[model samples]
Target: MFKFNETSPRKCWLIGHRGAMGHAPENTLASFICGQKLGADMLECDIHLSKDKKCVVMHDESVERTTNGHGQIRNLTSSKIKKLDAGSWYSKKYVGERALLLEELLDWIKEQKSCLGRALGLAIEIKNEPIRYLDIEKVAIEIVKKKKMESRIIFISFDHGVVKRAKSLEPNIPTGILYREPLADPFKRAKELGADAIFPRRHLITKSLVQNAHKHKLFVVAWTVNEVKEMKKIFTIGTDAIATNFPDRLNRVLSNAVKR
Candidate 1:
């Protein structure tokens, strides 16, 4: 059976957020390669639909924040968006690194699978909020199925409907709901939506949330936690996975946990 909850032989899964943004430019291939090198069990990337309806791997609706270009991803064609210098903002060494397609990332992952001896689960956060991409879930899932990588993917989105639609289309694919707000009952909400995982804001992760989520057979993957002190707290709370910008730091913490 496919399992996203279990991180056996280790206390928790170390997921690289935006491909270890702390080490390399977020969502760039260098970042993903760095994440895998640093021992991430999964690598996270954001997705948005370009003007021509191509799936682009990025965290923002606009390219201004992370790239040399300035425009909304939905407004630009994939060819236009893909040509931007996505790495220069981070460092001169990465100046020529261009933005990538979801397909490109999948291909790289496939190439790395044999070398690493493990396929990293991709925590694909569908960027549908603040600028909804029509039919994005279908577009995204279709690529995963085409690559034969549905078994190694997890669809997460702040928009509940996105995950719901994705699950409705492919029941075997694992889905997770992301929320920063306090919900009356998240586990119930996830169960109703057919999501087996919950990606809650780190602060909202209480002991009861983790325990009850597991009680309901749902898993919890906390988001973007960077500080070591906070990491230890989340570890104490027992999240299934802790997504972070520094997978190396998280790996160190997990190693120390084993030592103690």
Candidate 2:
């Protein structure tokens, strides 16, 4: 099995989607902290470049929905972007939450590492599509390399071109091609891009697809798996990892189902 992080790969890996979004606020620093506390082995987050080209941890192309700001994320400078309250929309308890810089999130994960005694992996997904934020992959590479997280960070993207760009910069770092549908020749596409992993939307992940990806020596990962039934199905199909909003729940369910 591919070892991600210094963490033992023995346990079924738990990857928190947007960092334990079910318990705290999605994609906020607080949510990530909550995820770590809830026994998440790895944290998954989306990356989008600020107008000034700094990588920030967020999933949306527009800021109007997630933050108090009103514009496309590509249109705002990091300074202006930082000032918006990112949490109040979720609840009053999270009133002052602000967008987190990728560097800050990395530092937080590193700190958690010291206590967990396991290298926590980060599934960093590139959010720029339709040719916006042309330099996002470059900025993401610089951050991952600088932090010495090249081994543990799995770079994934829906934009296959972005994944290709990342692989070009550093082939050693694992890259996953994220897809919403089961392509007719998924293995061929992954091989062409030099992708180490194939991440498909949860429902689309089947035993045949998993087997097909493995034929090309690619690891399989699935996203947004939050239910015990779905989680059980994915586990039986044998994915390398799963991105989930409810890591703790899945962990317990998985443990029970397997034990029974």
Question: Who wins the TM-score comparison?
Answer: 1
lDDT of 2 at 62: 75
Query: How do all models score by TM-score?
Result: 0.96, 0.92
Q: Each candidate: what lDDT?
A: 0.88, 0.80
**Pairs with backbone N, CA or C atoms under 3 Å apart (clashes), candidate 1:** none
Q: Candidate 2 regions off by >4 Å? A: 1-11, 114-117, 257-260
lDDT, model 2: 0.80
Give one digit per residue, the lDDT tens place, for model 2 in 31-133: 9988877767788998888778888787888788788888877778888888899999888999999998898888877667512357777889998685477
Off-target runs (Cα >4 Å) in candidate 1 are 113-117
| C-alpha RMSD for every candidate | 1.7, 2.4
